[model samples]
Each structure stands twice: as structure tokens, then as C-alpha cells.
Target: MKYNLIFGGIRNQDGYEENTEEVLRSFLSEEMEIPNVGDIQFQNVHRLGERSDGKERSIIARFTRFSDHERVIRAAASKLKNKPQFSIYQQYPREINERRKKLIPRMKEFKRQRRHAKLVYDKLLVYGEVYNPDAHREPPPTIPGQPLPNNDGDY
Candidate 1:
């Protein structure tokens, strides 16, 4: 599909069979305040799964156009920052999530060195550069239960 998928953080509610399209439209129009949100068309709008840990299911949406996706992401940052019951973000497959999880260690390793590391999506960047494990070589060793060293010799 040429479209990106979004997930709406839905809280618990009774009878989850409402018109998802209308709900999404109102959310974008009123909550997100995105211009011409009605112009955005969503496909496969539905809930993710049954409730778990007393948490409500999420609504999944697939819409075309990268501009619409970016607008939603930026609007979500400002609008949903204080709304716990509401959230909007792009959804990734399980494989991608797992890959990002595995990169956590590498991310920490780079940060410990004070090299300015950040993890975005499934990739890690150190000092504004993408990290390549093979080229970077194995990080310096440290004693068990000891923290890694920084630019200085101090731990």
C-alpha cells in the first residue's frame, strides 16, 4: 500500500461499533485542527484487538499522502500532548518494533560515550551520524556492574 497507517489511542467504551470514519473526521477537524481534514481518506479503519489489562482497544487507520501523515503527526504533538485518553501516531509492524528494541543496547552504548546518540524508528544515530556496528567496532569494555566511560577517563 502507498498509504501510511495511524493508530488512535482509544479508551474503554461500551459498544464499539460506531462509525469509525466519522469519529476520525471529527478528531482531525476539531481536536487536531487540521485544515480540510475531510480531504483525508482512510482505508481499513477498525479496532486493533480486544481489551486487555482493562485497557480499551485502539483504532487503526490507513490513509494516502505523506503530507497528511506529517500534518497528523505534528498536530498530535501539540494537541494530544495533554490528552491521555487520546493519542495519534504511526503504527509499525511487529518485526520493526522488535528490531528497534534490539537497538536499545546500541543506543545506550553510544550515549554512554557522550557521543550524542539517538534512536529513531529502527536506526541509531551517534553524533548526528548513523551508527554502523561493523565500522564502529565493538565498544570499549567495562567491568561488570560498572558504568561505561565518557570522553574523559572518569567513569
Candidate 2:
């Protein structure tokens, strides 16, 4: 889903954010200050589900252009680090999600060792190069029901 990204942890208000594209646009450019955000446009924007347990619902925004999606993701990968209350994520399909589940532990270990690792789609990049799992020995899989790494230095 090159054009989609999911963001959560922003405070919610009834009838806010989803109704107007301009509000979203300014939030990107003025609030988030994403570079070249004026060039970004949304085709559709909506919250994922009804708020439950008083938790803020995540919102999925579909970009009007692929480059806009890429630009936002890249800017978010860097900018959101300083803003813990907000986070943005590139959405993945089930197949890519499965592959990322396998790569996450290794990605955590790499970050623990202070090497750069970012998950892009199904592939993990170690120090900006595609991580080849077969080229390295990885830890055994975590127990099926246990918690996975909440943040594996992913972008």
C-alpha cells in the first residue's frame, strides 16, 4: 500500500480531522512541519474504528500521489522521533506483515548494537542495506503468544 499510512496517539474530538482535507493538510505542513508537505494531498482520510477503552483511534490517510506518500513517510520516520505523542506508520498487507514479524527480532538486535535498522515493507535494512537473514544467524523465534518488540527502531 504505497499510498497509505496509519497514525495514532493524537487526541480525538467528535467530528474532527476526517471531515476536512485542509485541516489535515495544515497539520502536516504547519503542525508536523513535514518538508514539501504542500505538495501532498489526500484522496481519503478516516479513522479506523470507534474509540474503545478511551483510547484514541488510529487514522489511515490515503495520499493522492505515491511520491507524496513516500515523502510523508520519510519525513515522519525522522520527525516523529522527537514527538512521542504522535507516530506514523506505513501500512502493510498480511504477507508483508508476516515477513516483518520474522525480521523484527533481528532488527531489535541490530539497533541494540547501535547499527541502523529500518523496516521498509517486508525487508529490513541494516545500516541502509537490505538485511539478508540467510547471511546471518538469527535468534530462535519468540513464543507464539508472547509480546513482540513494541518498537524495533522501525520507520
Candidate 3:
């Protein structure tokens, strides 16, 4: 449900559907050496998004259980490190994706400064420093007929 394996940079060719599942099974079982992954049940295995010219569409494999999903992710993390043609990602909700997007500028800033930075959920952590968007958010607008607070220290 919340977890899925996304396969990126795999080329789509004619008759791709006929061999995709088998190919993925072989890649995980043999190449990645993930034990018993072939026995894992996939709720769905399909390409995500529209096919674009000269671009390979990503493959999304939805597992029936979260544990199975995590296993695949863990296995792929180290196995695909040197393999540029393949990559894996945890499937996040749209809201989380949007929140992560907002932190891209900060992420880049950290990278430019040569500080290791990454986004975990809605917060951005750079060199163990936390940047919480909620903490810095502007206050909500005051209701109509509510008196505004004076700035001169008067009630």
C-alpha cells in the first residue's frame, strides 16, 4: 500500500509486457541476489506515466505486503549503487512529494556548501541540523472583528 518498488532507466521495447515480470524476477533474484524475491506476490506490475519520446517510463511494482517491499528496497540500495542504469525509490504520497519539492532549494544550498543533506519525510536534515517547515510557517490570518495586537507594548 504505502510501499512500492520503482524501477527506473529500463528501456521499453516491443513485447516488453510479455517478459517484464520475468525480467524483473531475474534481475532481483540473480543480479541483486535478493533471496526468495521470486516468491513475493506483486499486486501490480506496470509502467508509470505516459511514454515520452526518447525517455524510458518507470516501472512500478506494488507488493502485497510492506515487509516484502522493504526487503526489495534494502537489497536494491546496495546492489544498484554502481549500476547507473537502474535505481529504486520508495513510493510516497503526493503531499509528501510536494513537501519534498519545496525543500529542493535548501537541499541544493547545502550541496553547494558541501554539507551532506537529505530530506526525511517533511523535514530537511543537513549535517544533523533539522529544518522544519511547520516551525517557520506564517501564522494564520486573524478573524474578522478581532482586535489586532498593538506593537508598542500596549494591550
Query: TM-score of each candidate?
Result: 0.67, 0.69, 0.70
Per-residue lDDT of model 2, residues 68-148, tens digit only: 887777778677778888888888898888999999998999899999998887899987899898768665577888766
By TM-score rank, best first, the candidates go 3, 2, 1
Candidate 1 displacement at residue 86 in angstroms: 3.0
- In terms of lDDT, the poorest run of 10 residues in model 3 is 11-20
Model 2: number of clashes?
0
Model 2, residue 7: distance off in Å is 1.3
Model 2 alpha-carbon drift over 4 Å, by segment: 15-23, 35-39, 51-53, 127-155
> In angstroms, how far off is 64's CA in candidate 3?
1.3
RMSD of each: 7.1, 10.2, 6.4
Report how far off residue 15 is in candidate 1 (Å). 1.9
Report lDDT (CA) for all predictions: 0.72, 0.77, 0.78
In terms of TM-score, the best-performing candidate is: 3
**For candidate 1, lDDT tens digit of each residue in 1-155?**
23555555654344576777677777788777788988886666777777666665777777766777777778888887888778665576788778888888988877788878887777888877887777766677778998878867577
